[model samples]
Target: MYSTHLSPMQTYLVSENLKKMVSEDWRREKLHSNIAYFKTKMKNANRTVMPSGSAIQPIWIGDEKVALSVSEQLKQKGIWLTAIRYPTVAKGAARLRLTLTTDHTHDDIDFLVKSLVECTYD
Candidate 1:
């Protein structure tokens, strides 16, 4: 997964817009809320760490619709999805490893996690 570190200036810009531009403020507020939601979900997801330096977010592929949809969406957004399959991952240990980046908004990550959960559960 990718690492995200917000620079002070960037944080200030967002905070300022939250106080200035109405549209930008709304977007920023939504993103912040979404990030909080996703972070909570991730903490509960019981992700696994593989020997290959990859992180496996506890996703059950027996239900593929949610995960697949999220993966496709991520690929479309230039976020690569590295799926661990049967041959590559041990039995009953498949998952989606998302590499996060600084370029990604918190909203992007939230949407992704939400999409995965929706697809897997539905």
Candidate 2:
């Protein structure tokens, strides 16, 4: 029912972008580049981002209270990082999810890293 009955507009959009979505050029240029950019920025900031080969990198906060507090702080700063908690992870293993995309520029990443550092230290 999902793929079998996409609306006409949905079909049009997907068909139009399908080639780019699966293209090697897109992956090598956009996806891989953004991932590298984000990881490098995080590492340079000395933030503990778990090694993830994809767009979503997890920064472990370990304590649920700290994770939730940081999540709120980032939210107030206009960044939306969800605090992952127990049941999703073992107790004492909370984290903040950092997602990067081709739409994000280096400046954006820099500001995010700065904000993160500030939020954690404040």
Candidate 3:
């Protein structure tokens, strides 16, 4: 009878997590705080951040190769950022998609921005 086929335990865990997130105002406050923190860190690193109030932050690198290379370097550093390129977006608009989460710490975000600056700016 379950359309999604989730087990009862699965449903319970999911519901509990959702309730916790809602009770803590995850959407209105936490997401905003994370985004703001990310934006500030990126800006402090001399990176221009497009206004984004969401969890996903797309940082434009402009060149396909640069974006791919940076992404590879980040991967080697134990980060899992992805490079976005043509077909998914217009040419010359290559970018790295950074996903911020409630689980990310300030140190985590700082390290990411620092790594990106080293990869792209230096």
Candidate 4:
């Protein structure tokens, strides 16, 4: 028995569009490449890039106060990043989480890296 269900139209649309979605392999490769680029650039800017097994990379910013400050600054620059702390992560591990998506372009990644560096310094 099905525990969940989708309407007939939903099922048909999902089936038809499944192949159009980004492939798992492509997403993995792109995520790794972007993470590597950010790691290097952020390190140069004195920011920490927390290692992760998935596309979500947490950039430690010392504490919640700093994380929030950085998040707001980045937001002002048109970059929306979430600040993670407390219940989400341990105290003193406050960070800004960056998620890489298949829809993001290399230039987009570059802009993020540049913006991050600028924001941290400013």
Candidate 5:
């Protein structure tokens, strides 16, 4: 997914390769291991400081929608959001991106967090 953000067209392109990699036994195993590592890292990180929308899983909305929405949000403000989307996942599985980092204000997070929460249930 990080690879998707490296270039604009990468997601549309790499998704094909990603499917191929998963089809291969060895590659699939390696990918699973890598995913586990990152999942653990993301899960274990202290996210208390992050805004509500910045948490993992349920709060996130996947890459395409996330990228589009984040772009709109940033244009109004000035923060960049990173999203994790499907094809990299099984169908129907997607995430809304959030991060607990050193560079945001409560107010900055306030709008985003509020909006994301509203969007989720909607």
Candidate 6:
């Protein structure tokens, strides 16, 4: 038997409550803070963090081999990231793209940045 769910009115009320819990100001601040943290980490590692109007930022690694290896290494560390390679991008324009979301905490960003730095060096 299918479980009963909230009525339309109940659903609307729950949605409204969720909206009130997360304000636009709070979301914007969190996103900006996360991006700033990432930028600082990349800078300290002597890596370039590309600016984007979107939430995803690409850190150019240049070589496809390096990018792939780094992606795998980061995965082993439990930080999942994708290596943007040829066809999707020009040859020798490979990168590791990171997405910043309001749900991510400062510690989460730090771990990712540290893992990236360590993996690149490895």
lDDT values for all models: 0.53, 0.83, 0.82, 0.77, 0.46, 0.82
Ranking by TM-score: 2, 3, 6, 4, 1, 5
- Looking at model 1, residue 94 earns an lDDT score of 52
Q: Write the per-residue lDDT of candidate 5 for residues 16-103, one digit (tens) a residue.
A: 7767765668654544444343344444442212223322323334346654565456545545554445665544444445543333
lDDT of 1 by residue, 15-92 (tens): 896576555555556545554444566656643223232222334453344446656665775667755545555665
- Which ten residues in a row are the worst by lDDT in model 1? 48-57
**Which pairs clash in the backbone of model 5?**
54-98, 60-95, 60-96, 61-95, 61-96, 62-95, 63-85
Candidate 3, number of clashes: 0
Candidate 4: the clashing residue pairs are none
Against the correct fold, how does model 3 do in TM-score?
0.78
Show model 3 residue runs off by greater than 4 Å: 1-20, 26-28, 120-122
Error of 4 at 91 (Å): 1.7
TM-score for candidate 5, please give it. Answer: 0.36
Return the TM-score for each candidate structure.
0.41, 0.78, 0.78, 0.70, 0.36, 0.76
Model 5 spans with C-alpha error above 4 angstroms: 1-79, 117-122
**Each model's backbone clash number:** 3, 0, 0, 0, 7, 0
RMSD to the true structure for each prediction, in A, is 10.7, 5.4, 5.9, 6.5, 11.9, 8.0
Residue 7, model 5: Cα distance from true site in angstroms: 14
Candidate 2 has a TM-score of 0.78
lDDT of 2 by residue, 1-122 (tens): 32325699988998888667766566558767877877788788888888798778899788999999999999999999999988778899989988787788888888888888888632
Which tens-of-lDDT digit does each residue in 1-122 have in candidate 4?
Answer: 53225789999998887667556577668777777776777777676788886677878776788789889989998999998888767898888888876677778877887887777522
Q: What is candidate 3's lDDT per residue for 20-79, written digit by digit as tens?
A: 778677565766788899998988888866567678899978889988998999998899
The residue-level lDDT of candidate 1 at 109 comes to 70
RMSD of 5: 11.9
- Mind giving the per-residue lDDT tens digits that candidate 6 earns over 1-122? 44335789999998997788666687878788888887887788777887675668898888899999999999899987899888778998988888888898888888887787777533
Off by over 4 Å in 1: 1-39, 44-80
Instruction: State the lDDT at 66 in candidate 5.
Output: 52
